[model samples]
Target: MFPRLKVCCISSVEEMRLAVRLGADAVGLVGAMPSGPGVIPDERIADIARAVPPPVMSVLLTSAQSADTIARQADAAGVSAVQIVDRVGPAVYARLRTDLPGRSLWQVVHVTGPEAIAEAERVARHVDAVLLDSGDPTLDTKALGGTGRVHDWRVSRTIRELLDIPVVLAGGLTPGNVADAVRAVGPFGLDVCSGLRTGGALDADKLAAFASAAGVQRLA
Candidate 1:
């Protein structure tokens, strides 16, 4: 399957429009987080989620630690999917599957080392997809997302080979290296944030370059 494109940290309707126009399969809306960038209010997330048209996923990104809390936040935001940014227990995911039926729950697996592959395997059973990221939630400041550093693609490829579910790759992806990343990791999707931005704002040229490099053509 062709690798899909997801533009994260979409803060406004304008950013959503830009992302959809650039052929993004999904757009991430950041909710409250303990650290890192793109932390916005749930109310704002709801407004953007409502405005997003069909065929484009409005993903609510959260740092909530429990299944119930994440489910409630996703429900209240009215988003199509919930991207879990924290390292929650397996029971939490089990609960999410029951509580948020029909809604996609994406678990973020920070590739701190080879152990991440095992973590991905464990979490894959509960969530629809596993996103391999470069953030270390263990840090005292907690760098969940928006960290412009790439994880080991070789490890990601091993994880992808092991899991039956789709694996999405994130962290430090840019127009210059997305094609290489696709070849190396072979992930089902690519999620970008800081790579497609300039001066803390989404850059149209960068977005277009990234989409094109990722083989996502603009919809007519």
Candidate 2:
């Protein structure tokens, strides 16, 4: 199992490349936004997945879709892994697990209330890893993952303790306090959306600063 606490950024190809150039360990390809900051067209995700060079794994984001459909979509898009969020429970995750044909599925759990951690822990075996998101980004919410607000670190920490797989902590993470998150929760990795943006899109300078705070090593 991978033990490094790497940092990942989510956006289009331009932003993804910027994050990579700066110091992001990985980049996420927004799948079906419908609502959220990381929404990109399916074609865009496919293009981005192809554009990113090897070793820097590209991830796909999806909402509460069926496992078979999601797996197929991720495979079709050629992403290394699929990130699933939207208040799915253990049964749904378990059911989705069967849909993963050769693709890896990363379950993104929204830690809004006190029970989210427990729910995520219960569904830990259903996926490769779990991503802690927030409830603020509902389908109606215009800004998906870029609410610019942080959730309770203890929630992520608790979930991490319950699951053996890697945990990717997201939601309102920035260069300013990512280190605090790292120190507090000790997650397997970090995922950022709006924190690395200049305008509405991804920002090169912010990306660099976030990568630094995330502890991503500079490439030679």
Candidate 3:
């Protein structure tokens, strides 16, 4: 089966609609981040989330680590799911299970090296899915996501093979290299942000090309 497509860093409801219309299975609404693009306000995130139609999920990308804080952000945004950009403890995931019932929790594992394999394995059971991205969270400023840099797909593939949960591959995925990524990682889904945008805006042509390249069927 073709991997599901997720368009991230959606700045508005119009962008969200466009992404869904163009065969995106999910849309990512970025919350406040220390460093990265598409850091929209919580109110805007909530507004976009409310406008999202059913079956096409609205995901909130949050840097918040605490369970209560993350739960509050997710609740306020009213998103279908939450993507934790930073590493958090198992307790946070456990608390989120209760605090945000029925909502999907996705954990981001920065594929830095072989250590990423162990990191992803450790959290695979806690989240509904694991997203492998190219980011250095260890940096003083912290690059959580939206770096537009591709990481080692070999390491990502290792994580995918090890995890029972679905794996979503992100980072530097574009119309140009999505097929190669799919071949290498064979992830359950593909998430794109900067790659699908041009001049800080979602490019329709790029989105279309990416969907076609990824073999994603347009939503009727």
The estimated TM-scores of all candidates read 0.96, 0.86, 0.98
Work out how many backbone clashes candidate 1 has: 0
**Candidate 3's residue-wise lDDT over 1-220, tens digit each?**
2227889999998998899999998999999898999899999999999999888888999999999999999999999999999999999999999999999999999999999999999999899999999999999999999999999999999899988999999999999999999999899999999999889999999999999988889985
For model 2, state the Cα shift of residue 120 in Å: 1.1
Q: Which stretches of candidate 3 lie over 4 Å from their true place?
A: 1-3
The CA lDDT of each predicted structure is 0.89, 0.70, 0.93
Q: Over 4 Å off in model 1, which ranges?
A: 1-3
lDDT by residue (16-81, candidate 1, tens digit) is 899888888799999888777777788989999999988788899989897778989999999888
Clashes of 3: 0
Encode model 2's per-residue lDDT on 45-150: one tens digit a residue. 8888898866777777777466567767877888777777655556666665566555566877777766887778766777788888765444455334545678
Q: Where is model 2 poorest over a 10-residue stretch in terms of lDDT?
A: 1-10
| Candidate 3 lDDT score at position 203 | 94
- By lDDT, the better pick of 1 and 2 is 1
